[model samples]
Target: MKSGYNVAVVGATGNAGMVTLRILSEREFPLRDIVAIASTRTLGRVVSCGNRALKTQKISDINWSDIDLAFFCAGEGVSSKNAEIVADRGCIVIDKSSYFRQHPKVPLIIPEINLDTLEKGASYGIVSTPNCVVTPLVMTLKALSEVASLKRVVVSTYQSVSGAGRRAIDELYNQSKEIMTTRSSRPEVFSKQIAFNILPQVGNFYESGISEEEEKITCETRKILMADVKIAVTCVRVPVFIGHSMSVACEFSKALPTKNIRNIFEKIEGVIVIDRRGEESGYVATPIDVQGEDAVFVSRIRKDTSVKNGLLYWIACDNLRKGAALNSVQIAESMIKIDPSLSKFRKTYSRTKEA
Candidate 1:
């Protein structure tokens, strides 16, 4: 393996970008240098990397060939405009936007469920992270699907304002304060007043009456699980700031005991089960409790009496972390683990370019 790799993070000033930078440091990712990149307006701003400050550079000015790997945490517009350029310049791009997610050539990946897909996509130099909602959903479903044949999945998401971005988070804060003092607030970042309220719409509505976020959950789940399971989803914008929570009900091909279900989840590497249905165990996981946590927290497991061979549960995860930044980092780590030769290849390419 090479000594280390040079990395570039696009959209470095934004929520997901900043978290990606922090995760790289926290994980002690092997790196020779790290570049913080953003749009022209944010150029020259400073972003923290461990104890040091890295000045943000505009994406237009980056020399992609000099970077070994790039994380695209910018929005779909930025990603759509730049992802292929970076990849063509020989830098692997792990995009966290929805722009290239559905592309047949770009593998939509959740490392826990589909590292093999990622490995396959490496030849193309681009991989896409799924919608944050899809991450925990697929993680939980994959575990259950292994033990029981999943026939259908129904999910309702209580997503946080942060999922919308920094502006939405600011809107939530300002609106809550305004409602407390003036009894009125404007709804700009969201379609409705988010403070002391909930909005059933998380994204623009489609002709099918489903929101974009809901459609993403369904489509991306199917892609990740590679299953023809029937899926239904409703996404809501909740006032919480950092985590996304989901109420999931699944119908299996056969009845699986609650104990077996819980056992299955407990054995998974990135899943934590907090089921304490009938006792005062204080074991339920809420969005507030899961902020900054890495695990997909599952709780409230029970049988769904509405359908035979069905089960119900709740899940909470840090949308910005495991849902976005951390997942991208994990994908890169998976690349390294699956092919140690990648590090050697990156080093060889770097030296050849220098020469």
Candidate 2:
């Protein structure tokens, strides 16, 4: 409906926000204007988009009427308070926080797997992106589900420090340096030392014994599939810097041949299957290699002889990108594909205001 949409990136200085800005530029998203927004504390901080440097602003300072779209990566509290309010003013919001993933009215989307959900309209003028683990998990499963009924999924994640945010990254670096120098650095961002060590816990545990990250991956996966498949997960925080990795085992009701799995993943928009055997079996996808990469690289595909119709595989991805920033961008891209004006949501809010 217009030459280009006006866009904004909330939390522009943080990891996810920075990546979101870079992606918007890299993908050449049509934008008549773009603004960087962070907290009042970051008012003078400048961030980049392509060749442009943008000084950050507070959400309150932006003209909501002129903003056509926004990417919210500030965290749950920030998104819970601002994303919907921004949306209500007619700007389509693509949120990366856990706040809206399961909201009945907000679609938890993985663009490649469920872009069609955009056709239904973004109620509340908002869309939600899944967790880093859920993004790849759902993509692989959804593809497999097309050939078989997904009955159970078991996942063990070796997530990196960056998934916890920039602070955790600093913690890992400082601690590793301290250890190398035969000095000591007390853990700050993480509960324990993250250098040359692993923490089996990714998020806090619930009363039911499931960690928050585990529950999120499974819950979000089920929500996206619109199915009640059984899933068991263990989310571990590893010492890696940028990528998140997972070892997944899935059980399907119908038999799935290993030969078909590679083809299934190849067809996925942002997935790359690298399960080559012989000389390449030892070089499957790893966190260090996938850092900064956008695609979900899956490897080590095989059959789980222990379970009926079961498949086992490994996945690696840049959590800061596909897990957060790129997902928001893709949702916006899908929105544009459905309606350049993003009228599916803009009109919904406008009509609600008129009433």
Candidate 3:
């Protein structure tokens, strides 16, 4: 694996895509080139990468083989179409979509838990990022998994509007403003009024009444962290623009002390343990505090009195960063570090104005 490498970011104009470039720049990913790719409509649009504005190239016509690593932050439609095209060119793809997540061959990765799975390079496959809700939940559960065998998990998410992308964020803002002035609002971006209320659904509900988003959280968590752990989840979309918060209760195979569980979380990388006392004393990781930051915050640890071997905790993180972009970029960084042949492409990505 190499220290620096050429990278591509699909859907560069979108929220997650923009944050991906920011993280790559902040971490200084070695890049000889950064192909800022988008659909034909968004081609020629510019995205800020550091002080320079990188032009968005239309992904439909690009030569995939020219890029060593392509980070697909586009929608499921684009991902299903070209993720394999990029992979077939021998370029590794770290996707931020649900497309290949359930695929038997494609590894659904949260770098903290499953980097070992990527060590063996079979085909140039896609490594899919878990849902925003799943990332924080699984990380929190990993510590608990070691202390007492995790048997079941029940979580309810308070997710931000940014999880729905820029349009939803704008809708919340505009609707709130309209209500303040006109005392009325209408549903558009979300199924109902999100300005002053919480929407219980994150995505279209399936015949089972659970959203695709909720199902992903349950299914991806089981796949990523505890394969046998039974999960029950409820997802809600809130008005906040960024970040996601989860209140989780877990039932374990054996009884354990809460203090011991907290200590294990303290040592996990990328997890901040904030268990304290009083009104401002507890571990309160707000989405605003975590926006643009790269760590999962865990607090409010206590025993769940209702169930045996049960404990309750709260977790929060910037969904776009830690949950999607940063997670995918870290996977790309991991892959390059592991593959010796890919090392030559690493270098600082510089954009120059076209003549």
Candidate 4:
């Protein structure tokens, strides 16, 4: 641990990568220097990091040995190839990718849920952040699972085009314009036209009809919860641009009081309950409201009447922030908290200032 660490943001020109830089600057992470690394195509571009503009360097050009911490927001392919290399160079890598998530050695972390896993697995040198859809789902479930033992969970996600990447976002906008002007559109980034349409399938489906996205939710929920709860998931691509939303139903061993359930969520650090069920508008959280926010907004909470011990709720969160960048930055912050050696000045400054 040094007084200030040199950090690098991989895939710096991508949406998640850019957000990671912004968060690091917004949070004022203790850093000596910050570097942005991207693919050759993005090299030389400038990415805004709070008040600064960081010029992007090619990933191949990065000197991994010089970086103390690296946030990897590059897609799975790039992460798979470079994560180990970065770690081997003695740099801590917090990766936002699916490639290493399921690995027995790699700890898939949602700081609020399983940060201890990171502290315990520090020797591994690499930590993984979950998929965008898995983030809010697991965060909401952890609270309920603690109050009542979870038996099963069912989730249907309404993911946004941005989850696919910037090109997908552009495709959605372009296709919507074409449809409005000419009554026809083309699909390229997505399997079908994403504009003005909701695709029930998110990722490729297997013989059992479970999509890759669905499988991720199922496995990830179980892992993060550290429970054997059975999970069923259906992931859909929606027309929204930034936030990811999910309708989740959970079955517990015993019925949980609705008031108690609300209390549990309200007490959780990163969750916000917007339940206004009895009001004139009886408003609920939606993607538009949660686009740039870090907190998981949960609403429409109630007991499932059909089941003996079940609860239902709707949740929305910024996929790029809490789902990816913010979570990665939080992991770095948690590392500093858990291992004081990682922060060169935080402990000393606190003690000296108090004195």
Candidate 5:
């Protein structure tokens, strides 16, 4: 494999797939070629990558053997069936679905925290990106864990409709329009009314009383941080059309000052600390405000007066970009920067199965 490689953005017609193209162009990642791939129906669509226009192609008909790396932004089933085919042809597969994340051979990466895990999974034939919610929450906690030990965490997500894909965004818009016209709006994309109300469940409920979205945060956080940190998550669906936001309450091993914590977050990479002083001076980063931004916005920092070593704050990031596409692209960039042989060596001996 050469330093400059041919890369394919699978699912190029989807929301996350288009965002992947944007980040790759914005970062100016080195590439010998760029292939925008989607389903048969979307084959003729045009997507802008820098000044050049790339035509979408059918994933099934593409020659995966010519690709050096394939970014899977499509659904889990697509990734599950085709990721191995790409990998078998000597291409590194950086997947964005939950399908391969938990496999012992696959690494659920957050780039900022445990990129070392990537070196451990190259032998297994694939790499995995964590869920969008897990990315921002873990990115923020990575710095926090360094300052003081994190014992437990509680998160409530205010998720945007885009995370549910493009059709969901259209559903929200149509529903809102009907409500304004004083007409009946049927909920087709969601189980209940989402135009003006919030739903507590993001995914289906399991017998364990936790939704699948909540479980992703718990399991992925533990794997990426490599900690026994306990997490409780309540994923909520909101009317916002873009970005995902979370409110976090965390307990630490030692009491720390708010000023000191703020200072630390300011220096952490991939995080933008937007905090201020006083009652109304506090920081608040909403979905609409954070849209299209690469950095995770952190605000509303305050000490938990009840607990000896506790703190709370809000975090927001474009779920399509930083949450999925940006992070996957970052991992690929890391792989390219290192000796290509190292990726091969790491995969050859790295641990693929979990205990």
Candidate 6:
């Protein structure tokens, strides 16, 4: 109904939020209108939606009742403070932050892997998208879990600076340019210089030694897969600008050969397998190879000899796209498919700006 399925993109000036706007227009999602939302300081700034430019509004200034859906692409602090308020106001929120992820009423979704969760039950008008590492990582694991019951998974990530936000991207570039010219740069966004090196820790470590990203990966993977499988994640921030890559090893309940793995991945949508080894093979996907890509690129498929029924592979994806914004957009798309009414504005909510 053109009467309105008006959408709001919170944190519209940021990395993930901008991409969310782009994908919505690129896919021609059936919507009445779109609004770009950012902090009050950035209000009225113009941002793009495909070829169209949208003037930004602050989240508090929005009429939540008019918003059929809200994409929370801002960081956790913004999401924690506002996601539920907007969602509760009758707008279906597809939040990219970790704030509402574990909430029992919120479904942590990855459209390609767990779109069916939309059919399960009622939600609190909020849907949570997984962490960036978990998005591509669990997409592979979800496919594998179908072939054989997963026993354990070990993954080490080469994450991009974009995952940290636009400032981190600036830091990586400025630090790199400084290192080459002045041969010196201070580490500001990261704990150490992120120019010529990789930082093994993506976030603060817990008492158990698992880093913040690692815990989110493990928990979100299990939540999305809906399995009690064990997952060990080492999230390392690499010097890359846009993509996130991972080296993964999986142990299964049955012998799943490499060829079978290739076949399974080939049949899955949004996943591309490029594993070929020979005299002429450039069949590995690096962070640079996956920039702006939508599909998860899987390569280096082989068997892990140490464990029974184990397989190993490498995967890469644009961290900002598939890992966050795109997935949130996909969630909104799938939810509309599962429940058509969610695509239109509901009049039950108060029409006034959020109080």
Please report how far candidate 1 places residue 237 from its true position, in Å.
0.5
Q: Compose the digit string of candidate 6's lDDT tens values, residues 39-100.
A: 88887999988877899987778889878888898889998898778866788888899998
lDDT of each candidate versus the true structure: 0.87, 0.86, 0.82, 0.85, 0.85, 0.84
Q: What digit string (tens of lDDT, one per residue) describes model 5 on residues 120-165?
A: 5337668899999999998889888988899889999999999988
lDDT of 4 by residue, 42-69 (tens): 6789887777788998777878878888
Q: Which residue pairs clash within candidate 5?
A: 104-352, 105-352, 122-347, 123-347
lDDT of 1 by residue, 245-333 (tens): 99999999998966677798888779999877678665799998999999999998888999989899999999999999999999888
Q: Which candidate is the best by TM-score?
A: 2
Candidate 3, residues 207-282, lDDT tens digits: the string is 9999999889888887887376788889999889999998999899889875577787788889997767675644
The sequence of per-residue lDDT tens digits that candidate 2 reaches over residues 1-355 is 4588899998899999999999999999998899999988879798899999899998998988799998888899999888867877888888888998887767888888877776664367888899988998888889899899988999999999988987898899989999999778798888788899999888788999889999898889999999999999999999999999999999999898666777888898889887667673366888888888899999988889998888999999999888889888988887788776567766263445547
Lowest lDDT 10-residue stretch of candidate 5: 345-354
Residue 268, model 6: Cα distance from true site in angstroms: 1.8
Which segments of candidate 5 are over 4 A away from where they belong?
Answer: 1-3, 279-283, 340-355
The residue pairs in collision within model 2 are none
How big is the positional error of residue 332 in model 3, measured in Å on the Cα after superposition? Answer: 1.1
Residue pairs whose backbone atoms clash in candidate 6: none
Candidate 1 Cα errors over 4 Å, as ranges: 341-355
Note the clash tally of each candidate: 0, 0, 7, 0, 4, 0
Q: Please list the residue runs of candidate 3 whose C-alpha ends up more than 4 Å from where it truly belongs after superposition.
A: 1-4, 278-283, 343-355
Candidate 1 pairs with clashing backbones: none
**Model 5 score (lDDT):** 0.85
